[model samples]
Target: MKAAVASALRAARRVLAACHESPDGDCLGGALALCLALERAGKRVVVASTDGVPAVYRFLPAWERVTDRVEGLGSFDVAVALECADLERAGRFAPVLAACPVLVNLDHHRDNTGYGHLVWQDPQAASVCEMVYALLAELGAEVDEPVATCLMTGLLTDTGSFRYSSVRPETFELAAELVRRGARPDRIYELVYESRPPSAVRLLGLALSRLQLSADGRVAWSVVDEAMLQQAGARWEDTENIVETLRSIAGVRLALLFKVEPSRVKVSLRARDGARANEVAARFGGGGHLGAAGFVARGDLEDVVRQTLQAAAAEVQTGSG
Candidate 1:
């Protein structure tokens, strides 16, 4: 994997790095970290994402470098894909990636579809940022302030502040090293967890009020419709982590949040007590980790919710048994 990555970097003078649609911190951080590393290595880099950097992540160093559209971004010698399950997960950048000569897929999701010229995936890694950190070290690129800050944000967010089961001993070791290199945990915590907009709080209230539990009390779900977004003046990004609120309810093993978009319902699923949310997501052509996954369903919101809840309930039953 290192040899392939090194070879790609050596042959590339211009690189394009991108993440998944509606990207979370892990994907964004990994992409940004790699962009910084490549820039330091004297390569021209463009960081692209369909959703761009979320408000919460704008505090990271060089966050402004992220661009939303890659339509006419020209050609690149290599494209680095971070935390994307498949090429389609790149969203608007799919065509741009197809135009590139080489794609280096770096991810840590077991369900990844494995579609890249140079693929390096490790489900065991807590996040793709961990893999990026290792890659930078392998390339002997300096982990400067910008790189450290970006990578640490990924580690903190993906691990749930070191609370998730995916975290290992090495996670902390690397985190400490990043801190030593100028990553500020206090500042990142403030930017990500503590800096919620008022609209988001209102949206959370609407979502919580609509939360419903399954007959067996093992499955829980909520809907954030267009009406709710309009009422609360919240964008879809503000709905982040709302499913975690549902999963926090006592006796709930599987939690789902369905948000109504223009022509699709964005679904976020979370599991507890061995329920594999990824399987439920996969039934609808989505993929993620064991405990968290998501998908976009194009159809009537009510119908999509019904189908998703049914699958989620089945997983809850299977997990309980």
Candidate 2:
């Protein structure tokens, strides 16, 4: 699979690299790393992200190159969808990628839909950045300072600062190699984790204040509505990490966060070992890793929260049994 993707990329003169909608560090970092490497190899690369780069990830090299527009960019010889579970997960850029002659699906999600002409997926891999590192080696592209920094961003963020169970010995070895190639783990950590804006802090406080626990103490949840955003002067992106925070509570096996938008409620799910958060998310047409997943449902905030929490409670009950 690596050789196939490398061959396709080498053959293509113009390439489109796209990140999933509501992209996190893994998606943007891997896509940008690829873009930088491809540009060095003399290929014309355009990185697209419908939701654009979040402020926290703007420090990644070549992040400014990511554009939200797809029109008038012309067709590409190949299009690479990074960290997208399915083509539809590409969001607004889905049509553009589908129209490409060669579509490459590169992801680390367990529920990947297996779309695209060529796919390279590994559910066991810690992050797409890990796969991108291997792909660069397959293409014989240099993992220079800039490329290393971009890849490191994904590695650091996706592993939850090396706190997740997904981190393995190889993950650390890869991080060391990236550091030797000029990636600064300290700076990356500070920028991505420690440098939240004041508004984001305010939003986090609001979300925590609303945190609720199920009767059995196995399911935990919180809601972030438009009113909270307005009150805190924060954007929806500020809601990041709130679900993980919920999951950290003692005896809480399943945690959920419901973000009420104008048209839909976006629910983020996080669970400890043995709890299948993705299964719960799939009940609402969503998918993700066993420990982390999300879904979007169209309904009143209270209704969506009620339905999702019921499903989460049921999942916890089954896991405990």
Model 1 TM-score, 2 decimals: 0.84
Query: Candidate 2: deviation at residue 80, Å?
Result: 1.6
Q: What is the TM-score of each predicted model, taking all chains together?
A: 0.84, 0.86
Which tens-of-lDDT digit does each residue in 180-234 have in candidate 1? 9999988898889998989999999999998899849998889998889999999
Instruction: Give the Cα error of residue 137 in candidate 2, in Å.
Output: 0.9
State the C-alpha lDDT per candidate. 0.88, 0.91
Task: Give RMSD to native, each candidate.
Answer: 3.3, 2.9
**308 in model 2: Cα distance from truth in Å?**
5.6
> Any runs in candidate 1 off by more than 4 Å, and if so which?
209-212, 222-237, 258-268, 278-290, 293-314
Residue 54: error of model 1 in Å? Answer: 2.1
